[model samples]
Every structure is written in structure tokens, then in C-alpha cells.
Target chain A: MITITGLSKSFQTPYGKVDALKNINLEIKQGDIFGVIGFSGAGKSTLIRCLNRLEEPDSGIIRIGEHEITSLNKSQLREVRKRIGMIFQHFNLFDSKTVFGNVAFPLEVAGLSKRQIKNRVEQLLELVELTDKTNAYPAQLSGGQKQRVGIARALANNPEVLLSDEATSALDPKTTYAILELLRNINRKLNLTIVLITHEMDVLRRICNNVAVIEDGEITEMGPVQELFLNPRTDTTRLFVQSDQDLQLNNYSI
Target chain B: MADDLLPLLIVALSETVYMVLLSTIMALALGLPLGITLVVTSKGHISEFSGLNNVLGTVVNIFRSFPFIILIVVLLPLSRFLVGTTLGSTAAVVPLAIGSAPFLARIIENSLKEVDKGKIEAALAMGAKSITTIWKVLIPEALPSLVRGITLAVITITGFTATAGAIGAGGLGSLAIRFGYMRYRDDVLFATVIVLVIMVQLVQWGGNFIAHRLESKHHIGM
Candidate 1:
């Protein structure tokens, strides 16, 4: 569960100031598969980074299950990070590490013993169905396999909230569907709260329970995924849902 | 003529080999980190310490811009402190390492900068520290470039070592200077130049082969 109030971020450039995010407020409930959809530079990435305090907001109150993570110092924030995992679009497995090592790095950082870490990494690999590829380097894996390793590594600490920043954008459609399915299974199995950041509405339709539309650093629409489709308010949301020409012509139902 | 020339040539060859080998090792050991540091301390890279980058770049350029002949003179004291004398095979390596480390660093930094930032961002997203991302994603992905950078630096250092021999450091260059430049022995000079050229060619060929091996591995993986 996470809550944000009056968040704004402005960056200084040589010419003038640039506003990346402007006055955003939202609340994410426990066990919710929330998708934030926006075009490039809609500030979706920055917004999600703020949730885990990876990127600091100039003014905002971020409450991660009542801890107010925005106020924590570096060590305290790092502790909080252990409970909130993140995956990337490029499946950022450590190129230098074996798949097993990549998945176990978090466990190692958490100071687990060799036995405990091996056991946990093995369990994680099994969850992502990457057991056979344990010794393979990230460079050796296909795009889909790389993503599986990323997911396994994210789940290493048994994080309650998993943030996915365009995690499937770089993959093929088949791989995308499989990764989404994996996320759904993880959500059901662990009751984990997942926050997916993407620019694709099709992705929201596939896995998100709750969907939010962001435009020019503002949240224009947000509600139950099914409901948002039926009562799409913004031009952005309509374009997102009806992205396929045939879908727009057919008038999609919830 | 053959018997008289054999021992001297053999000794000269040994001296040249020692100079090249020691200087290359020193250059690699000291240069790789300097390059990594240049990348890390750059804006928006691993460490993102721009002030450090500026200071380091300035220092590197200052040393690099000075002529090699000047560098040997300037570093004479440092060479003595390091090797207790600045006129032998061992003594010359100090100048070679110091002179080329920064040049190699620049090459390394440029090479590392060519690695995909997308990969690095992904590592960071997974909660990796700055060091992990650097050593893991950045360095490995940049390996091919690093090999090329190292090759360039090594060749550059070889040239510097030969130039350093003018200050009395022993190598084929020193032998050539002694017999050919000072004593006016055209035969010794001709042979020395030919050997140095061949040695450089071999190094270049070896470096290119290794760089290709690394590049192909990366290509196959991707």
C-alpha cells in the first residue's frame, strides 16, 4: 500500500526550469495490480521512482504502509528498499553474474548465509522457471529468459510491493504475454502489490486490476480497470483503449 | 661478424622485451581503473561526480599534453624515487606507466561510455548499488571497447618507452641511441629500428586478435 500527496518535481536546465511531474496525488491499495499508462515523458517513470524513494520529489508526502518513506535517511531508505523490489524493461540482470548469482545478489546484500541464499535463489529460479539456466550469464539468455531472471531477482527478498517500469516493452508480444501471466500468477500466489508503468493500454487490459492514465505530468483518469474502459474520460485514455483501429470501430466493452 | 653481433643483439632484444612487457603490465594495472574512474566520475554515469571528472580530466590532459621528452625529464625525480635510478630497463617503466596511464584512462572512459545506458538503468532499477551496476553491467558490456582501448594504450606506451631510452634507460632504443646516434653506427641503428617496428606490429596484431575474440563473443550473445 502506498499513498502520495501533492507531488511535484522540477529540474533545472541551462535555458530554464523543466517540470517533469506536476502536483500528482494518488493512493494504491494493498494487493492491487495498478498500471500507470502514459506516453513518453508523461512523468510515469519519475512518479514510480518516487514511490520507492529512488527519485526524490521536490514536495510530497509518500506513505508506504505508514512508514512515510520520503522522510527516511539513506540507511533507513535502503532497509525500506529491501521490502519493495523493482524490475526493468531491459531485464537488467547483471551481465557479469551467472543467472543464479544475479538472483542471489539481493539475498547476499541482505547478509544471508551461503546455505540460506542458495536455497532462496533456487526457490526463486523455480518460481520463474529458470532453474536450468542458473549457471548461464545474462548475455547467454534470450530476451524472455532474461526477463524471468529479472523477476526472480526482484522476488529474492520476498518484497511485498513489486514495481515494474516498462518491464515488457522491449520484449516480443509472446514474451510480453508470458511475463504478464507470470506477474499475475505471482500476484495471486503471494498476494503481492504490483505497480506496472507502461504506455500501452493493451498491457493494462491484460493484467492490471486498477489503471491510471497520466498526461503531461498529471493523472487524468484512474479507476478500476474494467470501469475505466467503460467510462473512459480523457482523450488520452480513449486513444489508449482504442489504439487498434478495429477496436475503436468496434467500441470495446469492459 | 655473426658471432660478435649475436650476443649483443640477443641482449638488446632481451632488454627491449623487458621494457615492453613491464611497461605494458604497469600501464594496464594502473590505466584500467583510471579509465573506469573517468567514466564513473562523469556526469550521469555510475558515480556521477562531475567535479571529480573535471579535476581528473584536467590532471590527465596536463600530463598528456607535455611532450614525452619533457615528461621523462619532469618525472626523473619520481622515477628515481620509484626505482632508485632513472637510467635502466626498470627505471624507464615508471615514466611509461605514469605517462600512458592517463591516455589509457581517456580511451577507457570513451569505450565505457559506448556501453548501453539502458542496461545500466535496468541494473539500478533492481536495487543494485552504484558499484554493482558498474562492475556488472557497465564493465562486462564495455569489455570489447576496453580491449581496444588497452591495445591503443599499450602501443602508445611502447613508443614512449623507446623515447625514454634517450634519457639512458636500457632497451633496444637505448642501444640504438648509444651505438647509432652517439657512436654513429649505422648498422646498429638500422637493425634496432627494424626490430622495434616488428615488435610494434606483433603487439598490434595480438591486440586486434583479442579484441575481435571479445567482440565476436558479444555479438553471438546479443
Candidate 2:
């Protein structure tokens, strides 16, 4: 479970101060698939990055379970991070590592025994259906396969929370669906809390049970996914739902 | 071409090899950490010590700006102080390594910069410490470029060894000056040049081969 309150971040550009994230408040329950939807420059990335304290907030209180994440020191933050796994839009697997090595990296950093690491990595590779590609480098894998490896690597430390930053945006439609399905399966199987952000409405609709619509660094709407889809409160959310409908009608016309 | 000259050529070539190889090893030892520090301490980087980064950067640049000939003169005291002499192939190693360490550092910094920032963030998110991220992700990702850059540095150091011969370092360049220029035997000069070219070529070839093999393994092409 994660709780965020009064978070604000700003960046100084040549022109002036740019408020990337306004005073924001959010909550994600355990075992819930939460999606944060926003267009480019809407501070979606900053919001998610702030959860892991990758992007230091100018002011905020972030609580993950009982620990106040915003107040943790360097070593304490690292300890907190062990419970939170993050994936990138680019599938940032270590290019120099084999699939097994990439998945096992977190375990090694956690100082697991060699035998434990081998067993855990093999189990992860099997879960991602990448057993055959265990020895392959990231460069050699397809985009879908690469994302699978990324997913496997994220799950290496048995994290309670997985933060996905546009994790499926780089893939094709079929691959996107497959990755979303994988995320859903992982959520159910491990009871993991997933907080994913994307600009695509389809990405939110496919898997997210609870969704927050963000615009210009503020949360415009937040509720159950189906309720928001049926009755969007803000123009941004309405446009997203309308567009999804337009896309469905266009497919029918074709 | 005579028997006496054959032995002389062999000794000079070996001396040159010794100077260049030792200096390169020394330079690498000093420069690798300097390079990593430059990148790590940079603004917005993992370490993010801009003050330290700027000061160290300026120092590396100052060392790099000096001409190798001037560097040799400037380092004369240090060379003597370090190795108990300032006039032989052994002593020349000090100036040569000091002269090229900054150059190697800059090349290494550039290669480290080429690694994707995403990789670093991913590492951090996975609870990896800064040193671990640098060693596991940053250095390994930049290794091929670093290898090629060091090859260039090695070749450049080889040239510097010959220049150092002007100061009694007893390499092929010294033999060229003593035998070819002083004694008017152009053959010795030509032979030295040919040998230097051959040595550089061999090093370049080897560097490229190793870099390609590493690139094939590590480059993600994404």
C-alpha cells in the first residue's frame, strides 16, 4: 500500500519556474492495479518517480505501509527500495548481461547465495516464459521478449509493489495486450501492488481497476476505472473515454 | 645493416616497448578512477558533487593542455623524485604516464557518458548502490568504447616515448638521433620509423578486434 500527500515539484527553466507536479494526493491499496493517466508534460512520470524518491519532491509526505519514505536516509531509502521494483518504458535491461544475469542482479545486490540466486532466476525466467532465452542478451530479443525480461527482473526480489513507467508503450498492440495480461496475472498470483502510468486510454482500460486522471500536474479525477469510464468528470477524462469509443467505432467501420 | 647496428636496433626497440607499456599501465591505474569520478560527481549524476567535479575537471584539463615535450621538462623533478633518475627509459615512464593520464580520463568520461541514463535509474530503483550501478551497469556498458579509446591513448603514448628519446631516454628515437642525424645514417631513422609504424599498427589491430568482440556482446542496438 502507498499513500502520498501534499507532493509538489518544480523545475527552473530559462523562461521561469515550471511546476512539474502540484500539491498532489493519492492512495493505492494493496493488490490493486492503479493507473495514472495523463498526456505528455502532465507530470505523470514525475509523480511515479517521486514514489520511489528517484525524483526528489520539493515538498511531500510519501508513506509506503508504515515507513515514511520521504524521510528515509540513503541506506534506509535503499532498504525501502528493496520492496519496490520499477520497470521502464524502454525495457532498460542491462545490455551487457544475459537474461538470467539481468533477472538475478537484484538478488545478487541483496547478497543472496549463489544457489538461491540460480534457483530464483530460473523460476523468474520460467514465469516470464523466457527459459529458452536465459542466455540471450537484451539486444538479441524482440521488444516483447525484452519487456518480459524486464518484468522478470523487476520481480527478482519478491517486491510487494511494482512501479511501471509506460512499460508497454514501446510494444505493438498484441505485445501491449500480452504485457498487460502478464501484469494482471502477476497482480493476482503474487498479490502485488502495481502502479502504472500511461498516456494511452486503452492501457488504462485493459487492466487498471482504479484510475487517476492527471492534467497539468494535478489530479483531475480519481475513482474506480469503470465509473470514470462511464461518467468522466473532467474534459481530459471525457476526451480519453470518447477517443476510446471513436477507436472502437472506427475499427467497426473498417 | 651491420652486426653491431643490429644489436643496437634491438635494444632500442625493446627499450621503447618497455617505456610505452609500463607508462600505459600506470596511466590506466590513475586515469580510470579519475574518469569515473568526473562522471559520477557531475551535476545531476549519482554522486552530484559539482564543486568537486569542476575542480577535478579543471585539473585534468590543465594536465592535458601541456605539450608532451613541456610536460617532460616540467615533470623532470617528479620523474627523478619518483624513480631516482630523470634520464633513462625507466625514469621517462613518470612523465609519459602523467602526460597521458588526463587524456585517457577524458576519453573514458566520454564513453561513460554514452551509457543510457535509463540503465542507471533502473539500477537505483532496484536498490543498487551508486558504486554497484557504476561498476555493473555504467562501466560494463561503456567497456567497448573505453577499450577503443585506450588503444588510441596507447598509440599516442608510443609516439611520446620516441619524443622522450630526445632527452636521453634511450629508445629508438634516441638511436635515430644519435646514429641517423648525428652520424648521417638515414637508414637507422628509416628503420626506426618503420618499427614504430609496425608497433602502432599491431596495437590498433588488436584493440579493434577486442572492441568488436565486446561490442557484439554488450551493445543493445536499441
Candidate 3:
């Protein structure tokens, strides 16, 4: 479980002070696939990045289970980060490394023996169904394969929380669903808590048990996907839901 | 004539190789850490020590601004102090290394800057420390470009060694200017130019090969 209270962050831009995130409060229960949906610049990225202290919050109390993440010093924060895996929209896999090597990186960082790293990486590859691509460089993999590598690498440390920063945004609709299904499967199998930020409503409707609608650094609506989709209170949520349907409708013959 | 020129050519070529190699080693030893520190300390970087970054930048700029020929002359006193006498290829190494270090630092800095920011972030997010990120991520990622930069530095230093030889530093450059040009031996001048060109070609070819190998390994996948 992760809880954030009074979280706020602002950046000093050339124009003026831009508040990237307002006084945000939220809770993500363990094993729940929680989605934070918003348009570009809606603070979805900032909010999730803040959860990992990748983008530090100006003032907040972020408790990931028992650890007060925001208050932890440099080394402690690193220790906490090992338990919280984060993936990016770009699938930020190390270019220099093979699929197996990328998966083994976190294990190496944790000071695991070579034997242990090999075993763990093998298991992760098997889990992600990329065991055959163990020797292949990231360049050799397709978009879907790359994301699977990203997912395998993320789970290397046995992290309790997985933060997805628009992980499927770069993929095609088919690839996007495949990745989302993978995420859903991982969440169920490992019972790992996932906090994913996306502008796509299909992402939310497909896997997210609960949803939060963010607009200009504030959460305008929050609830289960069924409730939010059945009745969206805010125009932002309505727009996102409508756009996702329009996209899907376009793909269909009817 | 060929027999007489052969031994002199051999000696001068050895001296040129010796001067360039020693000074390049020195330059790399000094410049690599300085360059890494410069990048890591700059604004929005991993270390983020802007004051140190600016100060180092100014220092590197101050050294890099001086032309190699002028720098060799100006650094004579320091070279004399360090290497005991400033007359030969050995003494020439000091000024050459000093002149090249700053330039190499800038080259290395640029190469490091080209490393994907996402790789560094990924390393950091994986609980790797800043120093680890530099060694394990930044350096390896920038390696091919850095190798190319070293090749450029070596070629530059080879050219500079010729200038050093003009100051009585025994090498092909001195042989060219003295027994070749001054003595009106056009054959010696032609031979030395050919050797220098060949040396440059070899360095460039080797550097490109290594850089290409590294590039193929990653193929800019990130």
C-alpha cells in the first residue's frame, strides 16, 4: 500500500512559477492496478514520478507501506527504490545490454552472486516469455518485445510496487493491449501493487481496478473504473472516455 | 643516400611515436577524470556542483586557448622544472600532455553528454550510486565516441610533436625542418610527410574500427 498526503511540487520556468502538482492526496492499496488518467501536462507523470521520489515533492508525506519515502536520505531512498520498480513510456532498457543482461542489472546492483543473477534473470525471462531473446540486444526486439524486456527488468528485484509511466503509450493498439494484459497478469500473479499513469481511457477500463482523473495538477474525479465510466462527473474524464471509444470505434467495421 | 637516411628515419620515427604515445597517456590520465567531473558537476547533472563545474570550465578554456606551438614555448620553464631539461622528445611530452589534456577534457565532456539521460536515470533508479552510474553507464555508453576523441587527440598530438621537434626535440619534424628544409633535402621532407600521413591514417582507421564495433553492439537501441 502507498499513501500520499499534501503532496505539491512547482517548477520555476522562464515565464513564471509553474505548479506541476498541487496539494495531492491519494491512496493505492496493495495488489490493486490503480490508473491515473490525464491529458498531457495534467501532472500524471509528475505525480507518479513523485511517488518514487524521481521528481521530489516540495512538501508531502509519502508512505510506501511502512517506509516514509520522502523523508529517507539518499542511501535509504535507494534502498526503498529497489522495492519499487518503475518503467517508462520509452521502455528505458539499457542499449548496451542484452535482454538477459538488462534483467540481471538490478540483481547485480543488489550484490547478488553471478549464479543467483543468472537464475533470477532466467526466471524473469521465462515469466515475460522472452527466454529465447536472452542474447538479443534491445535493438533487435520489436516494440512489444522491448516492453516485455522492460517488464522483466522491472520485476528483477522482486519489487512490491510497479510504477508505469505511460508504459503502453508508444505501442500500437494491439501491442498496447498485449502489454496491458501482461501487466494485469503480473499484478494478479505476484499480487504486486501497480500505479500507472496514462492519457488513454482504454488502459484504465481494461486493467485498472480503480481510477483517478487528473486535470491541471488536481484530481477531479476518483473511484472504481465501473463507477467512473458509468458516470463521469468531470468533463476531462468524459472527454478521455469519449476519445478512447472514438478510437476503438474507428478501428471497428461498424 | 638511402642507407644514410634509413637509420635517421628510423630514429626520428621512434622518437615521434615515443613522444606522442607518452603524452597521450598523460593527457588521458589527467583529462578523463577532469572531464567526467565537469559533466557530473554541471547544472541539472548527476552531481550538480555548478560552482566547481564553472571553475573547471574556465580553467580548461584558459589552457585550450593557447596554440600548441606557443604553448610548447610558454611551458618550457615548467617542462624544464618537471623533466629536468626541456630540449628533447622526453621534455616535449610535458607541454604536449598539458596542451592536449584540456582539449581532450572538452571532447570527453561532449562524448559523455551524448550518453542517453534515460540510461543514467535507469541506473540511478536501480539503486546504483552516482559514481557507479558514471562508471557502469556513462563511461561505457560514451566509450565509442570517447575512443574516437582519443584518436583525434593522438593525431593532434602527433602534429604537435612535429612542432616540438622544431625546438630541438629529436623527431621526424625536426628531421624535416633541419636536414630536410633548411639543408634543402627535398627527398627527406617528402619522406617525412608521407610517414606522418600514414601514421594519421592508421590512427584514424583503428579509431573508426573500434568505434564501429562498439556502435554495432548497441546500435543506439535506447
**lDDT (10s digit) by residue, model 2, range A95-145:** 889998899999988999999999999999899898999988999899999
Report the CAPRI category for model 1.
Answer: acceptable
Question: How high is the CA lDDT of each candidate model?
Answer: 0.83, 0.92, 0.90
lDDT of 2 at B140: 92
TM-score of chain B of 3: 0.96
Give RMSD to native, each candidate: 3.0, 1.2, 1.5
**Residue B28, model 2: Cα distance from true site in angstroms:** 0.8
Off by over 4 Å in 3: B220-222
What are the per-residue Cα lDDT tens digits for candidate 1 across B1-222? 435455666787787788878888887788778888888888776678888888888998998898988988888999899899978888888888788877887898898898877666655545667786677668888887788778777677777767887888777777788888898877888888888888888888988998888766545455
**Deviation of model 2 at A154, angstroms:** 0.6
Per-residue lDDT, model 3, residue A253, is 52
- Per-residue error (Å), model 3, residue B102: 0.8
Error of 2 at A139 (Å): 0.8
| Tens digit per residue, CA lDDT, model 3, B114-200 | 987877887788888898789877898788899999999999999999988998788999999998999998888888999999999
TM-score of 3: 0.97
| Each candidate's interface RMSD | 3.2, 2.3, 2.8
- Residue-wise lDDT of candidate 2 within B1-222, one digit each (tens)? 766677888999999999999999999999999999999998778889989999999999899889999999999999889999999999999999999999999999999998888998899998999999999989998889999999999999998998899888889989998898899988888888898889999999999999999988866465
Q: Every model's DockQ, to 2 decimals?
A: 0.37, 0.67, 0.59
